[model samples]
Target: MDTQCGDLSAQSISNNYSTTAPPEPVHSTGAHRTEGDENAGGFGELTELPIEINERRPTCLCCGRPQKVCLCPFMPVRPLEVSTCLYIVQHPAEESRVLRTVPLLAACLPPEKCKVFVGRRFNEERNPELAAVCRDPKTLVLYPGSDAENLEDMKVDFSASVHNVLIIDGTWSQAKDMFHRNALFRLPKQVQLNSSISSQYVIRTQPTNTCLSTLECAAITLSIMEKNKAIEELLLRPLRALCSFQLQHGAQVHHSKEHLLRNGIYDKPMPTNKRKIKRMEQLVSNSTL
Candidate 1:
């Protein structure tokens, strides 16, 4: 229930960003001069040499964003103290994404509370720490399936012991592949959020309306495990600010695929495979109920 992160004024937030784009490199025509040109007393023929410019934007070490769009101001001033630990199994691709949410999730929690392991494969010998956590009785994996237990229905005694929660960070397909390929992931009890809340990550499209971002999943799980409902809101404040900033800077709000299909605005081509088509139809049917 701790909410100590202070807020910044709109004017102050806007002051950090520059409206203009980076200046383009200017080309110049000049005689090429080698290292020893002056000693040789001769210059190469006139040639147009493009001035090399370091175009890489200055990045903020804390949030891993360009200085202009850094989310540090919105982030919790200090990491939240929590008993439950989060183990994020992130796909390799997620590291390269400019707008990924895993960094945001890590920023909100204490360093020891949030640990990220990046890879598609994991084994006992190679990943001893992760393997050990997977074998722990209190460990639970956040994955949705017919066999998965709803996290809300589970009985947990927070005062007696802390829990380690594992979350997969990737696209739906990537996450599914990781779960099936890694046997260690299946060692822990699988749990899913049974909330009806829609995702607030407006900059990225989700497979379904019920689908939440990696950060959102972690926020909800942490709140439930810590027995602190306010933790969810505290974790989400930065995310909401990020999305709002993106929308103001020409980013469009992305609707979920399910929402697009239901509203008859889905522009993508239908699958040619009959089974795929049937599955899509079933999804559309279920959305109505």
Candidate 2:
């Protein structure tokens, strides 16, 4: 399905929300450099050519995931078409992660529905499309703040229009910096999901029970807004499978910061400087989940 700006509506979506969707082809591009032929004086020049890595050892073909931790079988066979469109503003550093869930989420949705913009700050010059979407009145940014309203507790009715969900993909500190530096993010109304479910990414530690991975947050928010229980349950299958694979491969289970603190098992982290203390405080206090 091709997505056009201001063309999405909940009434157009099928109530069953289940249908066959053809797999979208994933493309990879890169360039390789090699030494050119030696000249008469035994001097050589560099040459560049378009190259595609056909080696099957590092990456799996079925899913774009690394061969070491493939979770294709656990993922849904087709994309779930919903009323809400997910706009992810991902940190540049997150793309290199071996087990990140954004790729899985992207693979599960239509290419146009799950748009990602990778950068630290966005403007009309650098990212005009994103800036325009952020300016939409129906768009809502999922950031927690004292003045922000709870997503589940919103007093207004949303059955009449489309919703654009903007999520920042990064760790606690990176997300904070992204949120502060980006003026476009401040234009939308702020909302948050207050969920009791803990994160399924056990290999990585989270600062609070309210904390969830980008995938987890997206799933929960969509399920609640669309009022479809199956969305959250089915969308999280890859996360469970990935965590299981890691655990079997000798990865230690990590407990959430809130759990460890409440049980008196977490050590009191001592900050060496005032800057470190502020960052730590922000992490501990962050509850955007």
Candidates' C-alpha lDDT: 0.79, 0.72
Off by over 4 Å in 2: 1-58, 66-69, 261-269, 274-289
Q: TM-score of model 2 relative to the true fold?
A: 0.74
Query: Positional deviation of 118 in candidate 1, in angstroms?
Result: 1.0
Candidate 1 residues lying further than 4 Å off, grouped into runs, are: 1-46, 49-54, 287-289
TM-score of 1: 0.80
CA displacement after TM-score superposition, residue 286 of candidate 2 (Å): 9.7
lDDT of 2: 0.72
How accurate locally is residue 161 in candidate 2, as Cα lDDT from 0 to 100? 77
Give one digit per residue, the lDDT tens place, for model 2 in 55-161: 33465766665667777787788888887889999888776656677877787777777898888889988899999899999999988778678898987556567
Residues 70-131, model 1: lDDT tens digits:
78898878999899999999888777666778878888988899999999999999999999
